[model samples]
Target: RRTVRAIAVACMLTSATTAVGLASLVVSKTVMLRHFGLTSGLGVMVSYVVIITFVPAVLTWVTPPKREEVRRERTSMFTKVSNGLVARLLRWRWAVLVATDLFTVGAGYVASGITVDHALLDQFDETDPVYTTTLLIEEKLAGVRPLEVVLVSTEEDHFMDPEMVQTIQKIRNWAALRPEIIRTSSYGDMLRESYVLLSGDPSVRSENFKSAKQVKGLVTMMSQRDPSPLNDWLTQDGKKARVQFKLRDVGAQATMRFLDALEQEIESELGDDETVSVSFTGEAYTASRGQAAVVNDLLGSLLVAVVVIFLLLAFFFRSVRLGLLSIPPNLIPLVATMAYMVWREIPLNVSTVIIFSISLGLAVNGTIHVLARFREEMHTGIGREAALVRAARGTGRAIVISCVTLMAGFSVLLLSSFVPVRNFGELIAITIGGCLVATLLVLPPLLSVAGGDGGVRDSSD
Candidate 1:
C-alpha cells in the first residue's frame, strides 16, 4: 500500500507538472494577454492555473502506478530508504555550495547597484545591422525620449500677448538648470532672444522696428520666414504656449524624479493662478510612473501569496513553527532575484515585476510537496527519524521533476519577441533554478537542524 501510494502521488504530481508546463506554452503565445493589456500578475496567474489543472488530471487516468512493495519493518525503513540519496547530495559539498551561492548573490546586489543604466538603444549589440543603423540615424536625427509641457492661459488671446511670451521664456530658462533637460524650444524663446541685425553694421542691434525700416527686406536678407508659422504650436484660441524638452538615456526611476522636480518648478513659476497653468502629456512620463505603480502591485500580490501559503501550511501541519519556517525559504529566491537585478543592471520594468511575484508561488510549491509528504509519513505512526527519511525519499524525485517541468514551461518565454518578456523569462528561470537549489540543498540541511524527525509540534519555541 505504501509503495503504491508513493507511485500514485509521484504520477499525479508529474502529470500535473506536465499540464502546467504545456499551459504556459499556450498562454504565453497569446498576444493581447501576454503583452498589451493585462498586467504580468494576471498573465502569470492564468498561466500557472492552466498548467496545474490539466496535466495531472490527464496523467492520473493514463499511467499505471509503480509496483507496490510490502514493508517488512517501519523502524529503520526511512533511514535505509534515504541513505543513498543523502550521501549523493552531500558529495557535492554543502559548505562550499552554500558559501559560493551566498557570495554570488551578495556580489550581484552590489554590482547591480553600482552599474549605470544603459539606454534601450544601446542594448542591441554593434554587430547587429539594426543596431548599427539605429546608432547612425540617432546621431544625425533628434533624441528619442519624447516629452512636452504645454502652458495654457485662461483666455486664448492672452497667450499671444507679450506678458505670456516672457513668462514662457522664463520657464525655459529655469528648466535649463536641470542637466537631464536636453533642450527647450518655443515660439516665445525665438521672438524674445532672436533679433534682426542691421544690413551695414553687424555690431548694432535695432532699437525699434522702424529703425530696421524694411521688415520685409530684413526677413528676406536673413533667409528666415515670418514668425507667424510658430502659431501652429499654439492653442487655437492663442491662450496656450508649449515648451518642449527631451531626456537622454533615463530609466523609469530617474524619469519619475525628473518629472517630480519639474512639476514643482512649474508650480513655483506658474502658481494656481487663473491666467496660466502647466500640464504634461507624453508616453515616456506616463510609462515611468506606470512602471512604479506596477512595482507596488507586485509587492502587494507577493504579500498576499505569502499569507495564503502560510495559512495553508499552518492548517495542514497543525504547527505554526513549520508554517513560519516555510516563509523564509520562499523569500530566498525573491531576494536573490532582486539582488541579481541589482547586479545585472536590469530595470524593474513591467515584465520583471510580474515574473518576480509569480516566482514566489513557484519556488514554494516544491517545498510544500516535500512538507506534505513528510507530514503524511509522521501521521502514519512512523518515528520522527523514519518519517524524515520517508519524506525525503518519497518527495526528492518529484521535487526534481517539478523543477524540470517549470524550467520547460519558462523556456518558451525565451522565444518571446518582446524584450521585456524575455528579460522577465530569464529572471524567472534564475528564480526557478535558485529555488531548486534551495529545496535540494538548503531545505535538507535546515530540516536536519530543525529536527524534521518531528518531536513536539513547535520546534522553534
Candidate 2:
C-alpha cells in the first residue's frame, strides 16, 4: 500500500502524458496513422486504469519483501551511480546545459536536410531473394512497373484524327528519351508501326491516314495478340486513349522528377485547351503519390505529439516553467536519432518515420518519473540539491531498468529481413539510449536552475 501510494501520482502522470501524446494522431490525414493513434491512445488509458485498480487489490494477497532486502537494493551499483551522477551534475549545472544545447542545435540542423522519398524495393535487402528476383524480372521484362497516361477528349473519334495521332507520337518520342521509361506503347504508335509495314511506302504514317474510317481499317487488319486486344488501348467511340509506359526500377524522387517533366511535355504537345484531358494512373504513380501523403501525415503527427505532451506536462506539474523544462530531454532524443538517420542515409519511409512518436512517449514517461520524485522529495523540506540526489536514486534504477528492457525488446526487430524494419529498430534503440542518459544527466541539472527554495540547505555544502 505504501509503495502504491508513493507512485500513484507519478503513474497517473505518465499515463496521462503518454495517452495525450498518442491522441494527437487523430489529426493525421492518413487512415492508418489515425487508427494507430486512436487505438493506441485508448490502450494506454485502459492500461492505466487496470494498473491503479487491479494491482492494488492483488497486492493484499501478496507478501512484502524483507526490509533488509529492500535496503540492499538501494545500496546497489545503479543506485550508487544515480546518486553520484546528480552530485557531480549539481556542481556544473550551466556547463552541462550549454553542452546539451550545442549538441541539440547541431543535430536539428542536420535533420532538416532529410529528403522525403519512397522506394518499392527499399523494404528489402539487396541479398534477399525477393529483391534479386525483382531485379531479374525488371531486366527480362523491359521494366515491370506501369505508368498509364490516359488522354480524354470531348470530341468524338478524337484519337483517330491525324492531328491527335501526331500529338501522341510527339509524346511517345518524349517518353523514349526518358531513361526512367523503359518502353512506351499506345494505339496510335502501334497503328503507325502497322501502317509503315503494310503500305509498302516508307512515307506512310498514322498522320497519313487522314480519316477515322482509314484508321479503323488499320486497327482491324492488325493481328491481335492471344490475350489483350489492340482495342484495349483505344476505347470504343475513340474518345479516350491509354498510353502505357513501363517504368524503370527507380526511387520516388527520380519518379517524381520524371512525372513533373512528363506533365510539361504533355502540355507542350496538347497546348492550353481542355479538348484533351490528361491524367497519370498506375501502380508506380499511385505509390509515389501515397509516399508524399505519408511524409505529410507523419510530420503532422510529430507536431501534434509535441504540443499535447507539453500541455500535459505543464498541467501535471502545475507550473509552466516545469512544463517548459520537459521539452529538452524529450526533444533532443528525437533530434539526435534523426541526425543519425540522416548520416546513415535512411529516408523517412513507412516504418522509420514512426520512431519519433514511440521514442517521445517513452522519453516523457521516464523524465516525468524522475521529476515527480524530485517534487515529492522537495515537499519534505529538503534543499534542491538534496532533493535532486534523492530523486535520482529513488527513480533512477527503475527508469534505467525499464529503458534497458525496452531496448532489448525493440532489438528483436533487427532480426527482420526487411531493411526498413531493421533500421526502425536500430534507430529506436539509439533513441532509448539517448533518453536514459538525458534523464539522468541533462534533466536534473536543468531543474536546479528553476527557482525554488526549499526550507533546508544541502548538508554536503
Model 1 lDDT tens row, 1-461: 44444444434333333233223322332354234323543455555566556655676677554444323323245545455555544444457457646866785566456322234553455576766665554455545666788777777466555445555667777777777666667765444324532344533332333322233333233335565545545654567667787665466667778888888877776665667777887765766766666556555555655666677566655677667766656677777777788777676654566665467656677777766676677667776556656677767766778888888788788787656666777888888888887776665545554535442455335
Rate residue 261 of model 1 by lDDT: 85
Candidate lDDT values, in order? 0.60, 0.82
Model 2 lDDT tens row, 1-461: 78888888888888877776676677877787789888988899899999899999998898888999899998988888777878889899999999999999999999998878767678798899988888887888876689999999898888888778778878988898988988888787678777888877767663456787888777666635554366678865779899988888798888889999999999998886678899999987888877878877877878888888888777667766777888888888888988988999898876787778867876688888877788778878778889889988888888988899989999999999888889888998999899888888898898898725321232113
Could you tell me the lDDT of residue 102 within candidate 2?
A: 93
Off by over 4 Å in 1: 1-119, 126-137, 155-157, 173-183, 189-232, 264-274, 316-319, 408-421, 445-461
Cα lDDT over the full model 1: 0.60
By summed lDDT, which 10 consecutive residues of candidate 1 come out lowest?
18-27
Residue 330 CA error for candidate 2 (Å)? 0.6
Give me the runs in candidate 2 sitting further than 4 Å from their true place.
Answer: 200-213, 219-228, 451-461
RMSD of each: 7.4, 3.9
